[model samples]
Target: MSESFTINRKEQLLEVAARLFKQRGYAATSMRDLAAELGIEAASLYHHIKSKEEILETICFELASKFSNAIAEVNDIYFNAEEKLRMAIKSHVQIITENTNQSAVFLQEWRNLSEPKLNAFMKLRDAYENGIRVILKDGMNEDVFADVDEKFASLTILSTVNWINEWYNPNGKMNAEEIAQKLCDFILGGLRKKLVTDINYKP
Candidate 1:
C-alpha cells in the first residue's frame, strides 16, 4: 500500500479505538473488539499500532499536547487576563468540537494509561492547569479579577467548558466560538471583582 493510505488507515484505527474506549472504557476495550469494529484481523492491528495501551497513550497525549500548545499560544499574545481566558476557552471549545469522540476518550479514559506515561500525562495536565492559574493570578494582581483561589477558579473554568463535549451541537443556536463567548461571559461575571459601592450596598 501507498504511504498516504497507510497513514489514513492508521488514523482510522485511532478513531475506532477512541470510540470503543469512550463507549466501553479503556480497560474494557480489547484489541479484538477494535479489530471487529474495523472488520480486520486482530493481528493486523499490530501493523498499525503496538498495543491497546499505545492507542490510549496516543489519544490522551495528542489532546493534551493540543491543550498545552493552545495555552502557550494564548500567553504569547499581548492580551490581558480576561482576554487570554476568553481565547483559551474558545480554543478549547474548538478543539473539542473538532474531535468530540477523541476528546471524550482523552477526558475520561486517560487514567487507564500505565505508570511512566501516567506520570508524564499527569505532569502535562498539571502544567496546562497551571497556565490557567497564571492567567487568573495575573487578573487578580491587576485588579481585573477577584481574590479567589486560583486553583478553584481554574478548575471551575475547565469543568464548565469540558462539559461541552456532552451536548455540543454545531447546528444548534450557537457555534463553538459563540458558546465559548457565552461561557466566558458567565465565568468572568463571577471572577470579576465586586465594588463596595455596587448595587445593594450594605453601607
Candidate 2:
C-alpha cells in the first residue's frame, strides 16, 4: 500500500476503535471486535494497529493534549478572568464536539490505560484542571467572581463539560458554538453573582 493509503487506513481504524471504545468499555472490546466492525480480518486490523490498548492510548493522550493546549492558548491571551474562562470553555467544547468519539473514549477510558501511561495521563489531567482553577482564582482576586471553593468550582466546571460526551449530539439542534456560549454564560453567572448586600446597594 502507498504511504498515504496506509496512514488513512490507520486513522480510519483508530476512528472505528474509538467508537467501539466509547460504546463498550475498553475492557470489553477486543481486536476481533474492532476488525469485525471495520469489515476487515483480524490480521489486517493488526497490520494497521499494534493492539487495542495502543489505540486507546492514542485516543486518550491525543485528547488530553488537545485539552491541555486549548486552555494553555486561552491563558496566553490578554483577556480578563471572565473572558479567559469563557475562551477556555469554548476551546474545550469545540474539541469535545468535533471529536465526539475520541472525546468519549478519552473521558471514560483513561482508567483502562496501563502503568506509567496512566500516571502521565493523570498528571496531564491535573495540570488542565489547575489551568482552569487559576482563572477562577484570578476572577476572585479581581472581584469579578465570588469567593467560592476553588476546587469545588473547578471540579464542577470540569464535570459539567465532561458530561457533554454523554448527551451531546453533533446533529442536535445546538451547535458547538451555541453550547459553548450557553455553558460559559451559565458558569459565569454563578461565578459572577453578586452578594445580596451588593445587589441592594445603590452605589
Candidate 3:
C-alpha cells in the first residue's frame, strides 16, 4: 500500500499560506514570503508540500467544495422559489462570514490555477450559478418576483451577494443572521414593482 502522512508541518503551511494568499493574492505571494510568515526557511516547507500551487489548490478546492455542498443542501429543502433564494443568500453569507480567510482565498485566488484545474473549478462554479438561476426562474414563474429580465436579474442578485465578502465583518456590529435578513429584504424589494393601479387609487 502507499504511504500516508499524518498531520504535521504541511497542515501548518496550508493554514499560514491561506492568510498570505488572501492578503497578497496568488500572483504576488511568494514561497519565501509564506515561509517567513510561518517562521521557517523556504526550503523546509518542501518536506511537506511539493510547491505553492498545491497550497492554492488546497484552499480553492476546500472552499469550492464547502460552497457546493451548501448549495446542494439548500436545494434539498422543499421551500418555495422565493424562500429558496433567501436560504441561498443566507447560506452563502454565513459560510463566508464564518471562514473569512478561506473564503477570501477561494474568491480571489482562483485565477492562479492551471488550465486543467481551472476548467474543473469553472464547472463547479457554473453549477452554483445555474442553481441560483433556476431559483430566479421559479420565482418569476410564481409571480412573486416582478416581471424582469431573468438573466440580468440573476446576475445582479449574485453580484450583490458576492460583494459581501469585501466588507462583511463577523466581529462587526451586525451578526450574520441580521445581515442576511436585511439583504434578503433589500433584494426582494428591488425585484418587486408596485401595483400601478394602486398608485392613484386610495381606499
**lDDT per residue as tens, model 3, 1-203:** 25657546677788788888878888898889998998888898888888778889888898888888888888898468878999999998888888787888887888889979889988988888888888888887887777788778888887887788889877799888888898887888655667756422345
* Candidate 3, residue 32: lDDT: 93
Off by over 4 Å in 2: 1-7, 191-203
Better structure of 2 and 3 per TM-score: 2
User: All candidates' lDDT scores?
Assistant: 0.88, 0.88, 0.83
lDDT of 2 by residue, 68-93 (tens): 88898899984699889888989999
Show model 3 residue runs off by greater than 4 Å. Answer: 1-8, 191-203
- Model 2 TM-score is 0.89
User: Looking at model 2, which ten-residue stretch has the lowest summed lDDT?
Assistant: 194-203
In model 3, residue pairs whose N, Cα or C atoms come closer than 3 Å (at least 3 residues apart or on different chains), thus clashing, are none
Deviating ranges (above 4 Å) for candidate 1:
1-7, 190-203
TM-score for candidate 3, residues paired by index: 0.86
